[model samples]
Target chain A: MKACKLFRAGDRPVLVDEDAALTPLCSGDEREDRQFGKGLHKEIAALQEMLYAEHQRKVLLVLQGVDCAGKDGTVHQLFRKINPMGLRPVRFDVPTVAETARDFLWRVHLQVPRKGEIAVFNRSHYEDVLHPIVYDRIDGPEAGCRYAQIRDFERTLAESGTTIVKVFLHISKDEQRRRLQDRIDDPEKHWKFDPEDLKHREKWSEYHAAYEKAIAETDAAHAPWYIVPADSKPHRDIAVAALLAETMRGMSLAFPAGDPKLAKLRVK
Target chain B: MKACKLFRAGDRPVLVDEDAALTPLCSGDEREDRQFGKGLHKEIAALQEMLYAEHQRKVLLVLQGVDCAGKDGTVHQLFRKINPMGLRPVRFDVPTVAETARDFLWRVHLQVPRKGEIAVFNRSHYEDVLHPIVYDRIDGPEAGCRYAQIRDFERTLAESGTTIVKVFLHISKDEQRRRLQDRIDDPEKHWKFDPEDLKHREKWSEYHAAYEKAIAETDAAHAPWYIVPADSKPHRDIAVAALLAETMRGMSLAFPAGDPKLAKLRVK
Candidate 1:
């Protein structure tokens, strides 16, 4: 039933609730979390193979979240088993002089998947709405225009056979504080922590409101968004992977048929 | 002694003979290959960390070879230990409508590594010269201009702190025939055996001369070419891994220093 609900979002917009969005999937059930994670990985791997062999459709996965939302870990663990050849993950950061000179979507457009490819955007063009609007980088009319542009750009890509799946890894303020502190204490992970993260955290409510508005406005039939709980790493992996696998399993894919004469030869 | 000579490409543009070029270090011996691979992996990992932490220099690795010359195998083995976060491998194929419209370097410039990253071009801008020259796709002034553009483009990248390492995997005609036939005989590998490869094989002498000329013309102090003997997979892997590790070892890098007061804070 949960899996079915996940698939129902297909090519349809769904607004996520800000208050209840951080609901942990396995708050009271460790057993269920572990089982789901293991099963989802196998299913995702199979789905990935089908996508690769078909080589007709493209999948774009967008991961957006606050600091310590486990975006990187979720990607590394869930897609670890898939053949690296078919997977391309692009992480968006502060735009360079070259990127800023162009439209906000210019850098994002270059990373879009070609046919038979799966591309994951660690952070995406949505940042134009989420970050700039919240940080007051642009005023009302400008922000509104950029939002419409992103939605239209995504629509064009979908018409061209790109399947856009957006996921928001939602984490609570308390959890963010806990995770940031852990990074400070852990020597190996110290490199990941930055004081600037705290500056962003100070404007937590602003980011949350921006994200909520973006999800509600832009989540459309061509590109839908999924709000995944990010409190537990294993649960987050299972939920995200399960959603992707369920989405891909519904697609039509056929392997390329090799030459009949050549097919019979078995390498010894 | 071996480490110093490993990075030195001599005054020549390309090392035409494997035995003579690699005289500084013993190769082809199985024991030496194993030792070379292991040591090189460790050193390269360190270099990768420095490059990433310092976030200043960008490195590009270009691999070109005949089919079955072990390009795929070498990339897998050499980068097996490198941090995926710091490594970006771009494999170019037939041009798309978007790519074909621009200058030959347009698609490639998009994939260049950011500061403190390593980008590997499986078959790179060199394809403009290698493929076109081999197939008579272009000739006369057009071919000459393409070749000159490639050299100038690479020189500019190098001057901008992008370390360029070009490797041409060299396998004898007999060895290539043996490997291609092996792929044909194996069902799992049959997909890799392209009939078009045989077309290129028929013009081996022409390809060889074209490659020789391209290497000579393009190789410079900033971007040197390594003519790796790929008759043996293990030997090829060792040489490549060693060359990469030796290059990284030469770059001096220091870890990012964090504030001591902040580092001492414990938040529970």
Candidate 2:
């Protein structure tokens, strides 16, 4: 709950320090922070129920990170208490042939949360800007155009009853190396280890620059981007949980009122 | 597991007698059945991991039943042991405007299991046939055409290394009435109950007939339809789990052989 620079909320998106691997929110006691996060998950679940009951607005949590930045793991832990019906976690991998034919946002727009729902994009439209820019698939001008499009798309969503929270899971190059190494060392997790990830690992600095540019260009008052330090898995989980809890509470969601006549009527 | 009629693997899909409410799989011992189901879940999970490790095939479990037939509950109980990374549970509610824009199978196709994945469709494209026919929204000839289309769609999927297992969760009218009443009685569960279900309840017999005609018309060696008595929720869960286990075992899924080079590779 302390002031954490990682919890950035402003119109001008700030660049995260490359070495910003420190967990500012850590209570310095692992068990204490774990317990606190456990309680926060329950609170978020309760708040989600109220949001669903309110049945008017929606929440969209966009999670972006480099490979092994714990976006998937954070989702698995942060959403344990939430109802799967209300919480839609969509992991967008490489776009299909059909998806490629359309604008990048076309597929993403299809998955946005409807009324009284929470949708978490595991890796989102941000990938379009980051990957194309990093791989030289698109030049600087095209990437800028996409950043503007994303800003407008998110601004429209925010204007039309959606609370948007974007998080950049900032993990160090060394940490990512260790995580990828862990996957390679465990044969059970071999399905998750992609050879393409090593190709991306070779361009970590370029990716870091891509992410920084994407965040700075698209960040807005309506769509605030938080850079969460994710070097420590436990810290990453709790920090993201806190960020979600804080975002939901800021919406001031409450359960809808019932019809007074319904109180008098009993079901047959 | 003693010769449950639910596991119909024959090329000709048989009609589920409208009055068939018997839970043949139940060993007449609820506790024992629960314990047995508990064990089967772990086996299914292990097989799923191997399926992922093999990364050469996919499994698609299509669950179809009338309102309050426990499709959602069965999915929750059945795949609990399986890693969610591999288990994709898609509940096909009434299609939206965008979905209706394309052929019925277009949206369904988008959600099919990829290689090394297990996708469960709560209520699949079969709804396209059943609902229209039951309400006379489509005539007999048109219904037949749609059935043929589904058969082709599924055959294509099965030919491409996808294991397709379709299970009809058969619950009695009395059982559905009780379940609906339970939802009505519990305020907390009222969200799960829909008013439209009562209208559908009146046409239950017609829907069953529609299902029989569609299944018989579409059943092929590549795609077999099973009718699982679902009056007992626990029994329904276990039976579906068993059906999935049987299907995967038949596929002879095994982990890919360990690379000789990986045995010597070390991670720092």
Candidate 3:
């Protein structure tokens, strides 16, 4: 199935059920599936080079997922073959005092990808909608204002030459439990485990609802959201790669044609 | 020769000359030299992972060179095996109106590497001093004041856990002429060529004088300058990689030790 259609969160409010994340989207062979994923990654690298050479447009990939939904892993997998020169991966942690003092979009706006660049946000302004609502810090009207602001922000990015692709890595609660357990069990992986994750896990359903509302309200043709099944790490990588390759293919990216007069210009 | 000592710009005024740029600093075989360079690049990649995990200090690599001096090429080579998540390659162009309105270091200070990040500045605030002084826009006393300001700026970063490594890619005028000609001859590379490079070439002596003066004034124990000979691309890459690997080795970066109490905690 084409991931674009299968994973596209259209007008309907997208729901995350336990069984959906466990669905095997790839051919069952893990090794072959990883090879296929690598091919898609190579395609992304090629397209990104063209995007850099074209030097007229930009791409922003927003990876939003709950704790242990594989946002960081997906980014590492996607960029294994990509050049760091043009790829910017920004991880948004809790905002500082200065960030809170300004409008919510202030810091996010400062990091939009420049022309001929691709920027990936590990988590994004969507946090302002998700966390605050889950904690009862902001109510319905405040959320309505934020959703509208986000739509406007993304529209500005789109209107100005940036192609926006936002992905939600959908993982089942059971898978998250296994991942969290694995982190706690491995001494070396302890750094990845945060005690706060458990608190967030307790309110999974609330977070899911917030995600659904945010996606439904902010989704647009200019800035579409892809809901990728991410219970299986390999499947998550492949789906994101397929979605990005297809998005870039539609951009018609190419190297700029050289000026004809430059053929005769001497350097010395 | 230890690359640190060989390339170090010491107290005596460092001059750029054709003979110095042509000096052979590597093993004779080009293939063998590149293999060695790759090993150094890999070392940098490995050290960078630890640096990222350490998450306390930052590294800023400032690359200043004349037109066609391989600043961009060096960055690409150095990061071929490095993770993009922790690497930020910032290319500073002619400042926009907003940038010019502020203090010269305002935009630069904003782009300094954050904790755990390795930011490579393709061209840097040094341009603020070099270009202005070369064009007679800033007189001798003003240049001196700006130099002191830069030293103060760099000292603040150093004191606050930034390891600064400034490199000057010293290329001969003859080598630059050949590289510029090659760019003009290759249709695929025409996009990289700028007409204004020729205007800078005409005033190479003036630019060199400005560089010499700037380096002399800003050179500090914490923020030292390394003059890497760059007539041969492979030698230049090898020198830069070696310099970086050694610098990171001195940093004593390691993964943070996980909390001992967390070892007994079970994930549910």
For residues A86-200, could you state the per-residue lDDT of candidate 1 as single tens digits? 6776789889999999998999998899777888888889887888888898998887788789889999999999887888887777778889998887665566777788889
lDDT tens digits, residues B19-133, model 3? 4465456888878998898899789988988888778899999999999999878987888777777888898999999999999999999999998899999999999999999
Report lDDT (Cα) of residue B158, candidate 3.
98
lDDT of 2 by residue, A133-170 (tens): 88999997898899989988998899999999899888
State the local distance difference test value for candidate 2: 0.80
Residue pairs with colliding backbones in model 2 are none
Fraction of native contacts (fnat) of each candidate: 0.11, 0.02, 0.52
TM-score (C-alpha) between model 2 and the true structure = 0.82
- Lowest-scoring 10 consecutive residues by lDDT in candidate 2 chain B? B259-268
Worst 10 residues of 1 chain A by lDDT: A7-16
lDDT of 3 by residue, A1-268 (tens): 7778778997675666664465455898888898888899889988998899889899999999999999978887888777677888898899999999999999999899988999999999999999999999999999999999999999999999999999999988888888998888776677778899999999989999999989999989999998888988888989999999999999998778887888888766
TM-score of each: 0.78, 0.82, 0.92
Backbone Cα, N, C clashes tallied per candidate = 3, 0, 0
Clash count, predicted structure 2: 0
